[model samples]
Target: MSETSDSRAQRLAAESLAAGSPTAWFETLYDAAGRGAAEIPWDRGAPHPLLAEWLVQHAGEAAGADRTAVVPGTGPGHDAELLAALHFRTTAFDVSPTAIERVRAAHPDSAVDYRVADLFALPPQWRGAFDLVVEVMTVQSMPRTVRAAATAAIRSLVAPRGVLLVIGGVLPADPDPDYGPPWRLTHAEIEAFAADDLALEALDHGPDGLRYRAEFRRSRLLADTTSAIERTPC
Candidate 1:
């Protein structure tokens, strides 16, 4: 008996699964999408505008002069580069192996450490090692069912007395609900979550008013806490 093409394909798919691959279809999609070729849709071809704006505003103002910054779902590593340039020790990660490899390739001399790591299943060693956690459009890219978990994981990465910088788009007053991949984060929603364990330091206009730039500080209290309300706060 000889194996047919169909049988071979099945075998390969089964092997990939047995090897703990992401999804069987991932390779095919990446192949057609030119995964490592650069110019990915999520890539802005430079550091995100919101990230740049925040760095400019607080590059030297953060209380702790020496702290580690981590960028989850770091695509082309532009934001990580910006953090490193600002003198913070930086680590950037992406779930996609191709994306992580691309980051390293695109920035061979970058001071940041680029790694392949899932946002939800971060390595236990990194549980609370970062003083700054930067999340840019990552939660939106995930399934809605996992958004809360995604938010928790991101929050968990922040060290005590650290900050979380979130840059995302706004939802319509009455959104269609499913029209997302750019999931809108309502202001109320942000406050609700951040209030649970973090303090809202700033929720200002990002590069553009349409997109928001939010900065949160981890609460000092073991119990629930909230930051001072600020309409024009930092």
Candidate 2:
């Protein structure tokens, strides 16, 4: 009998964990999916509901006619497609080459630029270039030790006055030890994302207390001040 997709994913996840790479499984899974040997469990085939609602609420305001959005860990580009629909010049990137190809193939006419890139080593020009950065379940999928770096990297993608929307599993008040390939995030972990330049706007949990949605906004005032400082005479 042939090994099933779920089983393959499980095996890959185990290998990733054992290797301590934390992100290796992403490429492995995508490679399997590309070969029609495995299925991507999180490929919902549409933009996440939270993302859709966010776009509608800030339709004309936050996501104006000419803005840029980046979707990291863009599995099949569903969320990226939605952002493009709202007129944002969207860039969707995945660490897996095959994932990028799959999304591009799926949306042949899409204006969204799909690329293969790693979150940790993102193109320098992309730093603070996006008006909106959407990260859905990507950080939690990484190993615990690298989660902070991943969060910081995600934050770096947001430009001045930009918004970051994160959706992921949250660790329960009473945590479980055997918890994850989808590692659960804690309240402190989420709150720590806010800093001198970033501010937390909201943090809400799903009805069942299994998942959370966090919103952060970069300080436009700070950005402007920094720009002025850079332009000032020595």
Candidate of highest lDDT: 2
Q: What lDDT does the true structure give each of the candidates? A: 0.68, 0.80
Off by over 4 Å in 1: 1-39, 61-65, 206-208, 220-234
Error of 1 at 101 (Å): 1.1
| lDDT tens per residue, model 1, 1-101 | 86543344344445554566523322332343454322245667788887776777675643334889999888778888888887788899887676676
Q: List the residue pairs that clash in candidate 2.
A: none
State the weakest 10-residue window (summed lDDT) of model 2.
225-234
Tell me the RMSD of model 1 versus the true structure: 7.9
